[model samples]
Target: MFGPRHPLMLIAVLLIAAAPAPHRPRRIVSLNLCADHFLIPLADRGQIAALTRFARDPEISAEAARAAHYPVSRGTAEELLALRPDLVITSPWRRAAIAELLRGRGVAIADVPDAQDYAGIRANIATVAALVGHPDRGTALIARMDAQLDALGPARGHGRTAAYWQRRGFLTGAGTLVDDLLRRAGLANLATRLGRPALSRLSLEELVANPPDFLFAEAGPVRDQGTELLTHPAVLRAVPPRRRLHIPGALIACATPAYPRAVANIAAQLLAADRIPTRARSQ
Candidate 1:
């Protein structure tokens, strides 16, 4: 091995070792569900001052189980200020007023982008990891996610199509995270055929007239008109109960490093759906 030729080169190395690491925020708070996903994996527990109240909501937050171990916030600016966090992370599209107010008070606020695809997802992970002073962890997490996604294979549904049917018949459209997940599972989104926008309402009559090969809906009941829509005689007659897949919103609803789990879950459902004999299923 070759050594530093000059004594000054060795002196430079010594100075670098003696230098202190850059400052990292100690009290971190996640103001939203998606923000909790980033902070949970990237920060030390001691560093996490608080998380959003929804962190424990199994219906939405992906890290609900993990979030249970940390202190949860009430989502009010007053409660967040009580935590005395150096940083508050939330979605830019949501709570803009809170974000601005917090900034006015000299708190550093970072917004998690609503990542629609793998590239956006990767950028989001890297962004949060760097904020938490563990950029390397982000890199490793992405690599793991990529490997899992690769093993999951692509959307292999052939001509089979599906839709992420939500409350009030709100369909998640193309270019959204849910659509990307459906594609990764080898399923085409029915939203495309309907010419729906990023998010649009579809009447029961319309849905019944042009049903998809499958429907991706939440496992829990909404106890509202959405429930009525799901159980509607026309909808049942068209798609039937067997074609409905109950993928929880937590597995989706936001961009997280655990995205591969969503993709794998959907892919498994499609594979299982294929097993039903069409002749028998029609009746």
Candidate 2:
């Protein structure tokens, strides 16, 4: 005790004491489906503290099965805070109050913007990658996406002159992601052609009077009771059967890497419809 420790031993002790600890994310909470997509694929299995229940809903998420294993959390401040996550990821659409509360607690919150189209999807992917410290992986994923787009080749003018989207009376207009997807698939959006900012609810009479060359509606069971408009006898009588196509809601709603595949599916259907005999065209 009276003598000083050996210089080498003291130096070794100081070096051990001053050494930086390894960085490992201990807890992560994802508040939205999009964030679920980004966080689940990138984070270590045990690192994910919670995920949204919607993340396991196949209708909304492409990787639902993978996301189902994690504990689910609703987008509530108290629930998220209880998880004590080191990092939280959410979409812009998440409740503002929850985001505020988390930020107030000094937790790092990453707000990923909603993707309006394919490009926006890439941007969101990159942003999430950077936030999670996986910038290179993000770049590679986007490169693969760009490669897929490149494979689509020049757009052919084989689609119908006008196409109608009949999803819950909401029309995808110019400057919207659906409109851009339609254009990429070689179809002209009737909503855009009519100079409408987006879809204004139109009556069955209006639709019958000026029918689009093609009528596409959500393929699955109607969610809203009002969706009876799609199958009303009057609506059916007004629309020629040959002009209608049922597109899966999953194809059009989530703007993810799977979106290009959805566009391809739509384009294939449109091309097939174009081959129908003129006699079969809607009168």
Best by lDDT: 1
> What TM-score would each prediction reach against the true structure?
0.87, 0.78
How many clashes (backbone atoms < 3 Å, residues ≥3 apart in a chain or on different chains) does model 2 have? 0
| Model 1: per-residue Cα lDDT over 130-231, one tens digit each | 888778788888888888887866565776789888777888899898888777776778998878887998888888888898887656654887666777
Itemize residue pairs with steric clashes in candidate 1: 155-186, 156-186
lDDT of 2 by residue, 1-283 (tens): 4267678788998999997653446788888777777776666778889988888887877668887788888867778778998778876656466566866676777777767788888887877777766677778888877787778776643455444556456656777667777778777777776677855666666666666766776555667766766766666566666667655655555666666676766666766766888877654
Model 1 misplaced stretches (Cα beyond 4 Å): 1-22, 93-96, 99-106, 220-222
Model 2 clash pairs are none
Query: Model 2 — TM-score against the truth?
Result: 0.78
